[model samples]
Each structure stands twice: as structure tokens, then as C-alpha cells.
Target chain A: MAELIFTEDPEDPRLDDFRDLSTADRRPDRPGGRGLVIAEGTVVVERMLASRYPVRALLGVERRVRDLDLSGVDAPAYVTSAETMASVVGFHLNRGVLAVADRPAPPVVSEIIAGAQVLAVLEGVGDHENLGSIFRNASALGVDGVLLGPGCSDPLYRRSVRVSMGHVLRVPFAPLDGWPEGLNLLRESGFTVAALTPRPGSVPLRGLREKVGERVALMLGAEGPGLTAEAITAADLAVRIEMVAGVDSLNVATAAAVAFHEVAATR
Target chain B: MAELIFTEDPEDPRLDDFRDLSTADRRPDRPGGRGLVIAEGTVVVERMLASRYPVRALLGVERRVRDLDLSGVDAPAYVTSAETMASVVGFHLNRGVLAVADRPAPPVVSEIIAGAQVLAVLEGVGDHENLGSIFRNASALGVDGVLLGPGCSDPLYRRSVRVSMGHVLRVPFAPLDGWPEGLNLLRESGFTVAALTPRPGSVPLRGLREKVGERVALMLGAEGPGLTAEAITAADLAVRIEMVAGVDSLNVATAAAVAFHEVAATR
Candidate 1:
């Protein structure tokens, strides 16, 4: 069982990881200058406890701490007054509980792709909310993993984690360094890379299942600026969600969800 | 051609329709105390210009005003610096433009459902973002119309207009007054009302396509407290989007998008 510790001091040095969370995503002093993996709210804290990332500590109000199941956890859990907790975290957290964990080494792109039947590859999804929503969709649709190409945001960012409903911690994703050239790696691994775009000539999304049945990689880009010319050209085929005339393209995350369901079910 | 007036003062009386917008949604002195319909950004403002709502005026940066094709619009257009516009709107206007219009009379529920092949009926979807997302999904997937049940947020709220990418103006929606009892009205109109839930006995979403070939009304509820028991009981069938084990349900709007594609596909 995890050990429970009581702390009252807002300036306690032991609570350094829980400080000024509004700007916590950038930590110059930490390795790689990235913030620790933080999970807020009981549901997300429970997800962190189940994930592979090693939890370092927890800070929460007494009621929240009492609500958690700590049977197998070995980390220290700190219980404090909401006021002191708010002071320590630099803002009032409505979720009432937080868990901090170190970043685990990311899986290799090949390793994630190798065991997956369905995969989502994202490029230029710089917005954190879109990245998080994609993860949430990927998890729901049973996509095996995600590959992040250039211009993608950090999935471990606090906003991304929260928006993903903590699925970012559970879903395995690795950055693909090379641009459209690296897409060849997925093709070599027996995955058919289908670039999702709204271009005029692309086939509708429903036909993709008939085109690629086994290992499938659905490549998507940001909303307004869809897949780049090079990215679309490199894919085995281009697919699109047929939309109403004169309507703007669907939001990137919502579009991914639709495509994820379409391809994942076929496999 | 529409008249364009340049203004420097942030507190001009002509711009009153766009002032302190963060709290402008509530207007007891207005026609129905339901506030003016507000559209933000160039895309939504353009939609409002074409919608039935009477355009009161427009406040925007000079660049955004020039981008709009307002040949037929007669409302006064105020061109100002971003700073001045931000002060008038109560926050920084990232979209650079905003249009306020008097709310048009809502269509009757029967009028919206007349001759519809597929429909989305929402209950307790009071969050502006979720409501907007639902509208966007409804438009993209070709749902014929939306029926707002009790506790639904106003679809014409400014945030909904922007987040929906201006689709709210194009999609028709009206209130369903009789609650769960009123759902029978849809059945009377040759519709199969399927309640979307994750319950054990619910039919898979894909199966819904085979069961109902005629007019279908897909019923959805808020995220946490899914369709109320009364609502579910009123539904002709209970449907579910099959999700991964141990994962929470998809976001209400995302789920609706997936289900809409499944139920509305004619081919």
C-alpha cells in the first residue's frame, strides 16, 4: 500500500513537483527541459496509477486521497487542506487531486507500429487540444498506437493529458523524425499509409477499408492546413470524409475519430 | 455595397451590441432575455450575414472588414484597431472580427423535422463547446436537423457559433417541449428514435443502420449522466458505440459523429 503523509506547510520543499502548475510544462532544470508527467482529477490519477510511468508522489485533499485505492502503490501520498494545496500548486485546482510521474522512455516508432493492426500518424498537429483529442479517439477506436511526425505537440503536456482524458498516458506514441521520407518505414513494416485529406480527387473514407484491410496507418494533419503536398503524395492512397458542399473541413480531431472508426473496424 | 465606418473610440454607442461580450449572453431587457446572437471571426460572421438573424452591426479590425464580402449587407461596419475592439469586447479578439445580430424566430420542431431522413435530438447538452461540436458533426455527416430537448444550451451562443465553424447558422434546430413524452411526436412523424447509451443491453451502433431504414432520430444525452431513464425508455431502441474495454465513453460530440455516419449513410 502507498504510504500516506500529512503536510500543512505551503512552502514545504518536498512539494517542489507540485508548484506553479500553470507554467509547469517547461522545466529548464529538468532533463530535456520538459515538465514531469502530471495527472489531475481522480479518474486521471487512477489512469496514471495503472500506466507504465512511475509515480513519484501525489498531492490531494483528504477526501480525494481517501477515495483512491492505494493497495499496490508504493509511492508517498500527501494529504493537505485545499487552501494549502492551492497555495502550493499556484492555483486552485477544481479536480482536488494531482499525481506526478517521471517521463518513461518512449517506445521506438517501429516497436509501436509492429504490434499494431491500426495506427494513426499525425503531422503538423501543433495544437495541444487536437493532439489530446486524437489520443482519446485512438484509444476509443482501439487503434494500436500513434506516430507523431514533425510539428506535433507533446502528448504529455498537461493540457493534452487532461483533454485526452488521461488516454495519452495509456496510448503509446513516438515522434517520427524524418518527414514524408520516414513514411516508407511504415510501408516497409506492412502497413498501408492512407493520408486523410479533403482534396478533390481523394476517395471517400468508407472505401478505404476495401483498399487496405490488414495493417493500416491513417495519416492526418491540422484542420485548415491539411496534409502537405509531400505527405499526401507519399501515402499509398488518399482518403477523405465526404462533406456537405461549401462547408469547411471537419475539425482535425473529429475527422480522425470518424476515420479511426472506419478503418479500425475493418481490421 | 455595404457602408463602412471607421471608429476610434472603444465606447461608441453604435458598438453597444458588441460590448462586454463575455457576459452579453444574458439580456433581460432584450426581446426574450436570451441575448443577441453573436458570431465571431470572418467565417461565422459571413454565416451570420447570410442567416435569417438581423445583423445589428459589425466591429472588427480594418483587415477583417475588407476580407468580408458585404455587398448586400446594410448594417454599419465599424473598423477599428484590435486593441480598441478588444476593449469593447472585454477580451483580446483573436479572430479580429465579430458580428452581432438579433435572434431570429426559431423554427417549429415539426418544421425542422419535415421530410428529414436523419435527425439528432439532444438532451441536457448545456455546455456551449459540446453543443457547437454536435452541430459541426451534424453538418459534416449530413444529419437533416437537430431537435433541442430540455436543458440544452442555446445553439446561437457566440462560443457555439465560433466552435461550430459557423455550421450552426446553416443547420436548423428547434426545441422539443414535451420532454421524453414529446419524443413520441417523432415516432408519430415516421421516425425511429434511437437512444445512444453505453448500457449492457444497448444494440451496437452499426446494427442501427440495418434496423431503421426510414427516418431516424438519434437521441443523445450529456457525458456523465447519459440519457435520462425516462428518455431511454421513450426511445424506440437503445444504441451504443462499441468502445474498448475499461475505457470511458467517447466525448458526446465525437460519439454523435460516428453514429451519425453509421445511421445516415444512404448507400
Candidate 2:
């Protein structure tokens, strides 16, 4: 079990990781501008504790702190009043409990590909909420891993962590060094790289199962601009979710869920 | 052409319809706690103009107001500086424009069902953003209309109108009276009512086309506690999106999209 510490001081030095959290993740000197993983609320905090990321410490009100199963946890659990907790965190967090963790080494790209049956290759998914939602969807739909191409935001960002419901910690992801050219690594690994787009030449997402290999990579881009020409050309084929006339496409994360379900489920 | 009225005063009575917008949609005596339809930004404003709602007026910055095609609009478009727009609307609207319309009479449920092949029936979807997103997805995926069961919020709420990218104005919806009992209306009309759930007994959403009728009415509950037992029992059949073990179910709106694709797409 973890040691419990009681503190009422908002300025306590031990609570530095929990301070002024609104902008704490953007410290320029920190690696990735986000050295610590923050899990808010009980459900997410539990996920962070169970992840490969090393738990640093926890800060929460007494009632919430006492409920956590901190057995085998080496970190201190600090119990503070809600008022003092708010003062340190720079805002009132309705979730009541928060846990912080140190970033673990990301999984190797080749290793993730070798063990995965389905993967999502994302480019330019810069929105934090969308990125998190994609991870949440990926986890629920059984996507094996995610590959981040250029222009994607960090999945470990605080906003992404919270929005993904801590699934960002569970799903393995790594930044692919080269842009569209790097896709060759997957093709060589026996993965069919299929770009998701709405071009007329593309086939509908339905019946995609019959057209792909054992391992599939669904490539997606940001909502408005969609996948670039080079990315789409690198893939084996382009697929689209059939949409009605004059309507904008689904949000990137929502579209990813539909595609993930298609590729994961057996008809 | 619509009249353009320029004003520098934030207290101008002509902008009354757009004042204190954060709480403007919650008039107690108003039907459904929403009396006016508010469209924010150029895209949503354009949709509202083209919708069945009767335009009352428009408030926008000079650049955004002048750019609109107001040739046949019967209402006044109030032009103001950005600062004045913010002061009047109680917040900074990056969208730079706003339009208000009187609530139009909702379409009759029977009429909507008569012309629809695919429909969404929602229950306990009180969150404005989720309600808005569901409408947006329904519009994009060719779901003809939405039927609101109990516990659902008004889709025309300002936030819903904005989050939906104005699709809420275009997709017709009407309250479904008599709770689950009212579901008989769709069944009587030759529609298969499928409740979306993650229950063990539910059939997989994939290949659902083989089990349902020509017209499909999908019944969805809110995120956490899905359809109530009563609602599920009322449906002709219950269906589930196949999910990986231990992960939470998909968001109510995302789940709706995947199911919509299955019913609307040609595999």
C-alpha cells in the first residue's frame, strides 16, 4: 500500500507536479512539452496506475483518496482539502482526484506493427479532443496500435489524456520518422495500408474486408483537409464512408470509430 | 434584399434577441425551454436561413454580415464591431455572426416516419453536444429524421445548433410521446425498431441488414446507462456494436454513426 500524507498548504513543494496545471504541460524545457501524465477522476486515475507509465504521486480530497486501491503503489498519496487542492491546481476540478505519472519509453514502431492485426496511421490529427477520442475508440474497437505521422499532436498531452479517458496510456503509439514514405515499413511487414478519403475513385468502407490483407492499416487525416495526395497515393487503396450530398464529413474521431468497427468486426 | 442596420451600442434594443446568449435559451415559460432558434457563424446562419425556422433577425460584425447572400431575407441584419458583438452576446464569438429564428412547428412524427427509410430514436440524451452531434451524424449518413423520446434535450438549443454545424436545423425531429409505448407508431408503420445495446443477448450490428425490414428505426439511449429495460423490451430486437473486452462502450453518438452506416450503406 502507498503511504498517505496529509497537507493543507497549497504552496507545498511536494505538490509541484500538481501546480498551476492549466499550463503546466506546456513548459518549453520539458520533453514533448509534457513530461508528466495526468489522470483525472477515479476511473482515469485507476487506468494510469495500471498502465506502464510510472506513477509519481496522487493528490485528492480525503474521501476520494481513501477509495483508491493503492496496494503495490510506491508513490505517496497526498490528502488535501478541496479548497487547497483548487488553489494548487489553478482551477476547481470536478473529478475530485488526480494522479500523475512519468512518461514511459514509447513502443518501437516495428514491434507494434509485428504484433498488430489492425493499425491506425494518423496524419495531421492535431486536435487534442479528437486525438483522445480516437484512442478511446481504438481501445474499445480492438485496434492493436496507432502510428502517428507528421503534424499529429502528442497523445500524452493533458487534454488528450482526459479526453481519451486514459486510453492514451493503454494504446501503444509512436511517431513515424518519415512522412508518407515511411508507410513502406508497414507494406513490407505484410500490412495493407488503406487511406480513408472521400474521392470519387475510392470504394465505400463497406465490403472493405474482402479487399484487404490479414493486417490492415487505416490511414486518416484531419477533418476538413482530409488525407494529402501523397499519403493517399502511398496506400494500397482509398476507401470512404458513404455520405449524403452536401453534408460535411463526420468528425475525424467519429469516422475512425466507424472504420475501426468495420475492420474489427466479422460479418 | 435584407436591411443592414449598423450599431455601435451594445445596449441596442434591436439586438435584444441575441442578448445574454449564455442563458437566453432557458426561458422558463417558453415551450421546451427554448423559444428561439439561434445560429452562430456563417455556416449555421446560412443553414437556418434555408431551414423551416422563421428568421427574426441577425447580429454580426460588419465583414461577416456583408459577406452573406441576403437577397431574399426578410429580416434585418445588424452590423456591429467585434467588441460590440461580444458585449451584446455576453461572450467572444469567433464565428463573428449570429442569427435568430422563431421556433417552427415540429413535423408530425407520422409524416416523418411515412417518408423515412432510416430513423434515430433517442432517449435520455440530455447533453446538448451529444444531441447536436447525433443530428449531425444522422444528416451525413442519410438518416431521414430523429424521434426524441423522454429525457432528451432540445436539439435547437443554441449550443446544439452550433455543435451540429447547423445540421440540427435541416434534420427534422419531433418528440415521441407515451415513452416506449409510443414506439408502436413506428412498428405500425412497418419499421423495424432496433435498440442499440451491449447486452450479451443482443445481436451484432454487422449483417443486421438481413434481420430487419426495409425501413429501420434505431433506438439509442444516453452514454453510461444505455437504453432502459423498458425501452429495450419495446423494440422488435436489440443490437450491439461488437466491442473488445474490458473497454467502455462507444459514445452514444459514435455508436449511432456505426449503426447508421450498417443500415444506410450498400455492402
Candidate 3:
């Protein structure tokens, strides 16, 4: 069971990891200066404990700490008043609990794709909330894993973790190093890389299921700019979700869910 | 063509329709104390001009106003400095433009369902962002209309309009007055009202296409407490998007997109 230490000082050095979290994006403790994998609220903290990331410590109000099932938790859980906790964190967090975890080395791209039926390959998805929503959608819709292409944000960022409702901790993701050129690896491994774009001549997403075989990789780019010419050209085929004329395309995460349901849900 | 009137004062009476938008939710000019339909950004503002809602006025930076094709717009366009616009709206709006419109009487529920082949029936989806996202997804995925059941929020809320990318104005929606019992109206109109739930014995969303006929009304509830037992029991059939066990359910809007792609996109 985790040890519950009572702390009243807002400036305690023991609570350094929990300080000024509003600016946590630039924490030096994280990989490449991106913040630690911080999980807020009981549900996400519990998810972090279950994940491969190594948990360091926890800070929470008494009621929130008491509500957690810490039988398997090994970290020191600090119990503090909400006011003290808020002062320490630099803002009032309605979730009341937070856990920070060390970033584990990501799996190799091949490892994530091995034996997987479906995968989501994202490029230029730089928004943390969108990245988090994609992870949540990927997990719920049965996408086997996610591959980060060029310009993708870290899914372990604090905001991403919170937005994903902890699903980011559960989903496996790895970086695909070679950008558009790296897509050939999926092709070599028997996966059809389908780029989602609105360009004419692309197949509608609804008809895609009938054409693809055992393995499929759905490549998506950020909204507005969409997939680059090089990325779209490198894919095995291009597909689009038919939409009303003049309307903006659906948000990236929502589009991914539609594709995941059509391509991965039952597989 | 719309006339552009320059305004330097933040308190100009002509700009009242666009003032204090953060608290605009309770504007007296709106029907029943709800705010007017507000569209932010050039795209959304253009959509508002094209919508059935009667435009009251527009406030925008000179560059943004000049970019709009206001050939058919008859409302006064108030061009102002970003600082003045910020002072009036109570915050800095990066979108650079705003348009407000009076809420027209909603079309009868029967009117929205009359010619629609696919529709969305919502219950307890009170989150403004979620409601907006659902509208955006509904427009993108070809869901023809939306019917709000009990516990649903106003889709015309400012946040909803912005998050939806103004698609809420494009999608027709009306309240289904009699709650779960009112769902029979869709049945009478030759539609299969399929409730989306995770209950056992529910048909998988993938196979649902084969089971349902031409017309389908997808019934969805909010995220946590999904469709009540009564709501699920009232449907012609219950269906679920297949998901990994022990993972959280997809966000209500994302799930709706998945279901919409499965049942409505092709139709």
C-alpha cells in the first residue's frame, strides 16, 4: 500500500513535481523538455498506475486520496488541504488529485505494428487535446496502436493525458522516424497505408472496407492543411469521408473515430 | 452589399448585439433569455449570413470584414480595432470577426424528419461542446437532422456554435416534445429508431447496416449515464460500437460519428 504523508506547506521541496503545473509543458524533468506524464483526477491517476510509465509520487486532497484504491501503489501519496494543494499547483484543480510519471522509452514502430490489424498514423497533429482525443478514440474503437509521424505532439503531455481521460496511458504508440519515406515500412509489412484527404479521385471511406485486406494503416493529417502532397502520394490509396459541400471537415479526432469504426471496430 | 461603418468607441450602442459575449448567454434580446446565435470567425460569420436566422449585426476587424463576400448580406458591418472589439466582447477573440442572429422559431420535429433518410435523436447530451461537435459530425457524416430529447442543451449556445465550426446552423434540429414516448413519431414516419447503447444483446454497429432499413434515427445519450433503461427499451433495436473491454467508452460525439458513418454516410 502507498504511504500517505500529510503536508501543509505549499513550498515543500518534496512536492516539487506538483508545483506550478500550469506551466508544466516546459518541465526539465520530462524527455526533451516536454513535461512529465501527469495524470489528473482519480480515474486518470489509477490509469497511470496501471500503465508502463513509472509513477514517482502523488498529491491530493484527503477525500480524493482516500477514494483511491492504493493497495498496489508504491509511491508516497501526499494528503493536503485543497487550498494548500491549489497554492502548490498554482491553480485550483477541481479534479483534486494528480500523479506524475516518468516517460518510458517508446516501443519501436515495428513492435506496435506486429500482429496488429489496424493502426492510426498521425502527422502534424500538434494540438495536445486533439492528440489526446485521438488516443481515447483509438482505444475505444479498437485501433491496435498509434504511430506518430512528423510534427505530432507528445501524447504524454499533461493536458493530453487529462483530455484523453487516461486512455493515453493505455494505448501503445511509437514514432515512425522517416516521415513520408517511412510509410514504405508498413507497405513492406503487408499493411495498406490509406491517406485520408478530400481531394477528388479518392475512394469514399464507406467503400474502403470492401477493398482492403487483412492489415490497414489509416494515415491522417491535422485539420485545415490536411495531408501533405508527399504523404498522400506515398500512401497506397486515398480515402475521404463524404461531407456536405462548403462545410469544414470533421475535427481530426472525430474523423479518426469514424475511420476506426469502419476499418478496425470488428476486426 | 453590406455597408461598413467604422466605430472607435467600445461602448457604441450600434455594437450592443456583440457586447459582453462571455455573458451573452442570458441576453434579453434572445428567446427565453437564451443568447442569440453567435458565429465567430470568417467562416462561421459567413454561415450565419447564409442561415435562416435573421442577422442582427456584425463586428469585425477591417481585414476580416473585407475578406467576406457580403453581396447578399443586408446587416450593418461594424468595423473596429481589435482592442475595441476585445473590450466590447469581454475577451480577445483570435477569430477576428463575429456575427449575431436572432433565434427563429425551430422547425417542427415532424418537418425535420419528413424527408430525412437518417437522423440523430439525442438525450441528456447537455454539454455545449459535445452538442456542437455532434452537429459538426452530423453534417460531415450525412446525418440529415437532429432531434433533441430530454436533458439536451441548446445547440445555439455560443460555445456550441464556435466548436461546431458553425455547422449547427447548417444542420436542422428541433425538440422531440413527448420524451421517450415521442420517439414513436419517427416510427410512424417509417424510420427505425436505433438506440446506441453498450448493453449485452445489442447488435454490433458494424453489422447494424445489414439489419436496419432505409430510414434510421440514431438515439444517443450523454457520456456517463448513457441512454436510460426506458430510452433504450423504447428503440426499435439497440446497437453498440464494438470496443476493447475495460476501456472507457468513446466521447458521445465521437461515438455518434462512428455510428453516423456506419448507418448514415452511404444512405
List iRMS for all predictions. Answer: 2.0, 1.3, 1.1
lDDT for A243 (candidate 3): 78
**DockQ rank, highest first?**
3, 2, 1
Ranking by TM-score: 2, 3, 1
User: Clash number for every model?
Assistant: 0, 0, 0
Off by over 4 Å in 3: A29-31
Q: Which candidate model has the greater DockQ, 2 or 3? A: 3
Worst lDDT run of 10 residues, candidate 3 chain B, spans B27-36
Give a tens-digit lDDT track for model 2, residues B49-144: 888889999999988998899998999999999999999989898999999999988999999999999999999999999999999999999999
Once superposed on the true structure, which residue ranges of model 1 sit more than 4 Å away at CA? Answer: A265-267, B265-267
Worst 10 residues of 2 chain B by lDDT: B26-35
RMSD of 2: 1.4
Q: Residues A1-267, candidate 3: write the lDDT tens digits.
A: 899999999989999988899898796655587777789999999999888889999999999999998899889999999999999999999999999988889887888888588999999999999999999989887888899999999888888998999998888999998988988889888999999999999999986889998999999999889899999999999999987776788899989988888898878
Between prediction 1 and prediction 2, the one with superior lDDT is 2
Instruction: State every prediction's TM-score relative to the real structure.
Output: 0.97, 0.98, 0.97
